[model samples]
Target: MAEITAAAVKELRERSGAGMMDCKKALAENGGDTEAAMDWLRTKGLAAAAKKSSRTAAEGLVGVAVAGTKGVAVEVNSQTDFVAKNEIFQSFVRDVTALAMDVNDIDALKGATMPQGGSVEDVLTANIATIGENQVLRRMKRIEVAQGAVIPYVHNAAAPGMGKIGVLVALESDAGVDVLEPLGKQLAQHVAAAFPLALDETGLDQDILERERAIATEKAAESGKPADIIAKMVEGSVKKFAKENALLSQPIVHDGKTPVADVVAKAAKDAGASIKLVDYVRFQLGEGIEKEESDFAAEVAAAAGISKG
Candidate 1:
């Protein structure tokens, strides 16, 4: 029996687009023959799945799941929005979001064994092949509180718990679920609509603030005003940017007048419960992934084995 080397496994993985472990197993089962290993992966449809992996997957669903005080949000991307409506694709997103409640990150979620069988990554590969499109298990975030409710909201749900946007609001308080759940849900809905960058101004990313400052400086400089006035203008611009992007400072989505901080405070006062908005996560499907463009007619003709005149 020939000994399988790391290089051999890597080559098979590159050639077949199967997981590293799968490639190694295939090589071992095929007596370290790369050609036989490729054939093995092809027989399982993994090769085809791998081939599709290169395609950009910029449309799909964001799913949210909550269990008691813990909640999670996940994004799964596909090459086309049509797959977002597929029952199988929807199920995958729902299941994965639930799985994320226990896992810490995307890698852990992928490594986790699904209830049905096989790892999450295995199931994703199978889905890619069977669904006939590139798919990505892009990201997952989990938020939990020691006490209180972690409420979930899905906007424009394609299916239960799955949608184009998923938001989870973690409220830590001594309040009963009867009081906390509704408040949390309201905040979750606000989060989905407002798309806050952070829970407060302090939580906003420094890089984002720096970018805003640079732009404000450029705009202020164009006014040809005195340096002190320009400085004041830039300061005002940065502060406004922070207020608009931060969750607590942003105006409440429902009321359009009360700031979120005041809304939470008022809700706490009304309910007679001390509620703290601990954290939040909002996932918009394919928010950052870039989609690829190609000539559709020429590609269709090429696929049909026809030459363009």
Candidate 2:
């Protein structure tokens, strides 16, 4: 048996696009022959992942998990919505979300160890091989509050805590968890429904605001008004834009009339606690990812090695 160096495995993986472990095993089995290892990977169908790797995986669950004052949201995307319904996929998302509670970002979460005895990336690779689709751990966010609660909510959940949309709302206060949990949940749900861009008008993205301002200016110019009037129109439009996109200024989803800031104030007063909505995170599955459109029949023909008519 020939010695299989790390470089050999790396080369094989690069050539075959197979998982690290698989590449290692292939190299070992082939006595460190790179071409043979590639053949082995192809024979085992593991090479299929490489072909599918470029496919857009925009459908999967957005999972949320909360641990005491900390909460995390994760989005795991797959090539098709059907994979989101799979029990194995759901379990993976649930476990990954739980694992995310301890990690600060997507890179750390990917490097974190899964409960099932592998690194998150390793397990994800195994899932892609077994599940027969390209899957990606797209993004994650963590929110924590020192005194209040970090609440989680899932919208259109395929399973508890796993869904197409996941939200985390962090409230800061000296209030009891019992009092804060329900309020946090309501706020989380509102986040999922309203899709606020920021916690307040001040937090809104400057680029986004500028884009809105430009659109408002264009509209105002079309009004055939005086320069001062157009300036006022643009300012008013920008203000309305801020209010609509800011969580604190937006109307609460439940009442449709009360501003979120007022609702939080009222909730705090009713509980006799000073609750402050601090931060929030909302992950909507496939929100920004662009899915590839392909010809199904041509894809089948190509996969079958048949020439097009």
Candidate 3:
């Protein structure tokens, strides 16, 4: 057998755009012949998959799975919406979500033994080959309940029980799981729709608070009001902003007449048990990716051999 060195792997990776380990393995399996290694990668469809990796995969699904007292949410992205609707892709995402429920740490989840047959990485590689598109297992979060249950909600439709947005809510209490699960799911749906910035006032990001304060200060200064009055106005606006954008401080969606904190209190009273809203996780598909905007008219004219008007 020929020697498979780091230099050989690097050369193959630069040619194929495959991951380092994958390139090394390809070279080793092909007897350290660069041409054979490239052929091997192309034969496995890995090179084609790697070529598409740089494409923006902002369109995909948010998957959720709840197992007993624990729940997990996952986002798997693809280059096109059509691929997002693929049954195989949806199944892969569902299985990955369940894996997330079993493993709390993200790195551990990535390396966790896949439910199918091999390691998680191996499964991803196989999916890339089978799916004919670049795919990513982007994020996962686990929610657990000490006493009650963790509930899930998904918006839109990418799968049977998954969608574009997924939320997980953990309710900790001694109440019957049968009673709390429905209410928890409703709250999770609310969170997905409302897009709350924080769980409550206390959980609001400090930088967001500062930005609001600055905006309020600028607006108040323009009024030429007295210093004390300006200060009071800024404080009032800040308080209102915090309340409106935070989950627990906002009105409950089910009733729309009471704040979420108060709704939790009422739930506890009605359930004949003390239920605490411990924590929650919400994942919106493509929340932060910068989408590219194409100039459609210009492209059309160019294709038709016409000069710009």
Candidate 3, residues 1-309: lDDT per residue as tens digits?
A: 889977679767877888898898899898998766775775555664111112232888988888878888888888788988888888788777777777867678779887777877678778889988888778888878767888888876656668888888989988987778888977887887667788889999897787667767766787899999999999997898889888888887777768888888988999889898888888888766755555799899999999997
Candidate 2 residues lying further than 4 Å off, grouped into runs, are 1-57, 297-309
The local distance difference test score of each candidate is: 0.84, 0.84, 0.79
Ranking by lDDT: 2, 1, 3
lDDT of 2 by residue, 59-165 (tens): 89999898888889999999899999999999999999999888888999999998989999999999999999999999998989888888888888899999888
Clash count of each predicted structure: 0, 0, 0
Deviation in Å, model 2, residue 272 alpha carbon: 1.2
By summed lDDT, the worst window of 10 consecutive residues in model 2 runs over 48-57
TM-score of each: 0.78, 0.78, 0.76
Clashing pairs in 3: none
lDDT accuracy of residue 287 in candidate 1: 75
Give residue 50's error in model 3 in angstroms.
38
- Candidate 1: tens digits of C-alpha lDDT, residues 1-309: 789988778767876778999998889889998766775675554664121122233899998889999998899998888988899998888888878888899999999988899999999999999999989998889999999889988887888888887889999988898888888888888988777888899998897787667767866787899999999999998898799888999898898988988888988899898999989998887775656657799999999999999
> Which has the better TM-score: candidate 1, or candidate 3?
1
